[model samples]
Target: MNYIDNDPRLQTGKPAGIDKISIWIHPFLIREPSAFHPSSGNNKKVILRYTSRNGFSIDFQAEFFDPFKNIFIQILEYLIGLSIRGILKSPINKDFSTVEKCFCTLFTDLFAIDCIEFYFDFMRGHLILSNITNQKYKTTRYSNNYTREGKSVIIAYDRIERLKYVNQMNYDEISSIIYPMRFEFKLNRTNCEYLHPTNIFGNYNVIFDNYLIFLAKRWRMYNQQVVSIPVLNNLYYAEKFKTIIQYSQWQFPYSMMNLEKTPSCPMPNKSVKLKDIDRNWAVQFSLKDWV
Candidate 1:
């Protein structure tokens, strides 16, 4: 999703009438050669390029939403998807309806969905919900472009060009050439519907708390397994960008949250079997083992 232009109306206490929905949703993939990429300008011939299932094919008119909105949507969606898969601990094949029901309940209750146009951001991520029924009342014109809070978060992905690795962050802090978002399914024009990946970050600490539990459990199951967010290699870096919380305490710049230590398995003490004068034999056997 792209930011088309800065509106003075936003300062004048008027609705910008600009679409900002793209800011919330980010797809799972980043398109090569960004919209502003030198090559992108040259390729603006208005030809019908087959839009990726998750990418937009609109002629980005200045009056229309900005191209940046497109990029923003793409990145936001990707982060959401990752959180669903990684944090919510949901499986991929779960029914879309069930996922949507759970998502709306959790997100709306937690973040106040009535005030936020997350679907627009989801669209940016190239995630299309098959059923738009849930999003019916949210499609206002200018309201789509701006949030009451002037500031917003962006999921700047890493290694989008090479691999699908990413780091969640605010827009101002991202430095790498990354896609704004990635979508789970390929784009389909006929249906024109999609849903975003379930995301965990953004103002909510519950996701972080849940992640800690998941991580600890996984670690307990297999201690040697590497616990990595890849992008969060160092605590200093995370602090600089204010990225997601790092699992390792040493890697966190601020006071990292501490998890309750897992209790150890208890060992049982043996009781003598009082059978047929077997006390002497049992004592002798136990003593031999100890010896």
Candidate 2:
């Protein structure tokens, strides 16, 4: 959805906008070099064409083209339709935009969308990615994310905890504001919509819509969950109980928070299950913040 420049809420990083994008162009297929149209002195031609070989690929922070007068966009659509293969990346962290940086390729291998990763940073619900879904697919978990493979592939993982080591942290120091526990979704060629060269912008909207639907459907599946405790689980549990016991004279003791042994997964127990599994991050999410 190419929107007007005046629309503030639909800024880049928002649901309708993209964080990073990769485009692959087959110059051999683009024989119509005369398609480019010129404009005013400074804002003239849209593309800075360069030959491509061994290399295949190629936004704006918000809107690449001003909806009002966009010859540049028109030329892009035309060229893309002629020869294009692309990878479109979207970030769940709308607050931090990471636009792609593509330069002309002479010897580099073509850019491939091996998979698309949707990072739900600081949010969690491991069970959802455990295999539950509205659509059926082979589900498997290794390393961190849940993966579904077929016409397309999707990978979901924990962002904060995975990066804990970068900050010199073990799971012992997690935060609720950074919760419920964020996840990342990785999608392959078949699953990504932003690859359509002629309609990258339009496809971006579809990508965002599909994501919101996936989350909404999963959220509606159950009002609560009985969860397995990981080192991360203890943190979620600790925060959840604080709210539950707020009125009780006896507060939940910090010592009872299972903080022994420095084991990453917390104390080993076979039968411990926490119910009404708290998704603190999702609980506080508002679509308005995105759109």
Candidate 3:
């Protein structure tokens, strides 16, 4: 039930995709007064919350990036439901009120992006060794945050486990997510513009595609340095890793990376002693393994 598209990620029991995204729409874009209750604070100082009848909510403020409810997640769910407001599916129904139509039209608007966070489930044999950015990484038990308060924050953490430990969750409350090790890259408006000069605001697929672009770029590099068989990992990342080769900096890693090491044990008694040498007894990796 997790992926109705028969997405192979279900096989891995992991969630891999855009984990979270935040954007700022021009305040005037949403003028439903009934939706914005009241606030005595000045326009610059006050934040307004908007909740649609269907339980969709987004907070608004005039600033580019404020702590107010800058998250608009319901749109992602809407896209998953096979609804793209007529772009990918069917056009908007004509029976809607003027306000509804106005809201629907802006779905195509070039968004003034605020923040986009990309994440994935990270299991064993993963190490974030990329030092391409000039910023120093802030290390914590749960995450490696690069560029804490700048154009972006590239962080890798197992927040699910962090929550379990921090909140002292019971076994039942603990999340069943395996290898919850996740990589999150949050880009501010400036970095977002750099990645996609044309801008990242478009349909849901477009937003997700940009995240894919980043994930692919990293996957290509990370695969090479990994200690495990790249193909086995590729098989693990069927949902998201396959596209990485599309942006491989150099040629993708060869199947040889998956070679197994089998070490012979010492003889049963003192009479014979086996050498400590490691034996790669299995078959060599085949080129087709990556296919």
Per-candidate TM-scores read 0.18, 0.30, 0.45
- Model 2 misplaced regions, further than 4 Å: 1-20, 27-152, 165-180, 190-194, 203-207, 210-291
Model 2, span 124-171: residue lDDT tens:
543344533323322222322223543223333344544453464446
Shift of residue 65 alpha carbon in model 2, Å: 13
lDDT of 1 by residue, 1-291 (tens): 112124333221111111212221111111221321212222232211223431322222113222223432333343345334442222244444544443343332111100111111111222222222223222211111124534211111112321322334434444342232221111111211121223223221332342343333322332222122333233221231122222432343222433222222111112323352212433322223211
Question: Highest TM-score: which candidate?
Answer: 3
Better of 1 and 2 by lDDT: 2
Top lDDT model: 3
Against the true structure, candidate 2 has what lDDT? 0.30
Quote the lDDT for 256 in model 2: 36
